[model samples]
Target: MSEPVLELTGLTKTYKPGTPGAVQVLRGADLSIAPGQVVALVAPSGAGKSTLLHIAGLLDLADQGRVTICGQDMTGKSDRIRTAVRRRDVGFVYQFHHLLPEFSAAENILLPQLANGVGRSAAQARAMKLLDRVGIANRADHRPAALSGGEQQRVAFCRALANAPRLLLADEPTGNLDPDTSDQVFAAMMELVAGTGLSALIATHNLELAARMDRVLRLENGRLTEITGQQAGAGFLQSD
Candidate 1:
């Protein structure tokens, strides 16, 4: 079998540790996402889901744990090495679009590739392809402010995928849109993922959205529990 795209073992994190306001967010949380699999992470706000993703994406480090990406262990790696690995192997999206207001959608996607050393002409072609994949080829020249909410998010999705990373980490990628727009944007995202066959771990509160993924994971009290079969529908309701 192919090695897992992302792995977290014994991940533990504490905010304000050893202080009067210490809070432990993760308690030895463990997860393994195989290549081409899409996993949904469901949790309430302040439930440490963002922390988990940050750690997984190498944006932050855990107090005690190991993060392995594409078969490489990231324990105690230098910031430079971590950044390189993250740029080469991981893509991240958040609730907000966070696109540059001044840059066009295609430019936003192309910039990352340029930073990663791709030539301008090739990056431009790749950008248009990604925008087309997300059903926004015509909006490629429009800035974020000119696009609709769903269009902006779709551009953000393309930007996140510009480098063709092996793993995608998203925290509520569609949380800001209306139900209809969210569904549409999410479908585009899934199609993009399916086309690339990259592993994705998306955190979302929308149970309906979570149920569509290959697996559902509930994160509570800093630990993760897999929910499958009928439980996928009924289990998330308990959080409400």
Candidate 2:
């Protein structure tokens, strides 16, 4: 079999380690995600789900562990190298839209590509195509302030895909949208990822949405466990 797109071994993170207020968030958390896979991460608030995502995405460093993305060992890599890898191979979406108010939807989507030195024409073309794929081509020229929450989120989705990342990380992506809009956005994102065969690890509280993913795992007591097939079908708790 091919190597996993993402791999974490003995990952651990502690805040204020060696200080009086040190708190351990992850205790040897381990996980592996194959290319083109869609995995849902379910955990209660303050359960360290976001912490794990940040570490796995290389946005934050683990106190003790290893992270390999696309077969590249990230351990001991410099901040610059990690940042480059993240910009090139990882995409992130947060609960909030986080789009710049001054930029148009298309421009916002093209920002990352431009930052990576993609030509203006090529980046714009790719951004426009992503916006079209997400069903928001008509709103390309609109700013975040001019769009609805769902539309803004759609724009953010397009921006995340602009880099053609190998791995996508989403934290509570649909937490702020209404049920119907949330479902629609989630479906659209999944469809796009499926089409591109990109791997994704999403942290979400929406059990119904999580149930539809290829696999589901729960973060509890600082460890990751596969959700039972029955529980997956029944859906996880919105609160837990």
RMSD of each: 0.9, 1.4
Ten contiguous residues minimizing lDDT sum, candidate 1: 231-240
Top candidate when judged by lDDT against the true structure: 1
The TM-score leader among the candidates is: 1
lDDT of 2: 0.91
Candidate 1 backbone clash number: 0
For model 1, how does the per-residue alpha-carbon lDDT over 37-132 read when each residue is reduced to its tens digit? 999998767889999999999999999999999999999999999999999999988899999999999999999999999999999999999999
How big is the positional error of residue 142 in model 1, measured in Å on the Cα after superposition?
A: 0.6
Q: List the candidate 2 regions with Cα displacement exceeding 4 Å.
A: 234-239
How many clashing residue pairs appear in each of the predictions shown? 0, 0
Which 10 consecutive residues of model 2 have the lowest summed lDDT? Answer: 231-240
| Residue 5, model 2: Cα distance from true site in angstroms | 0.7
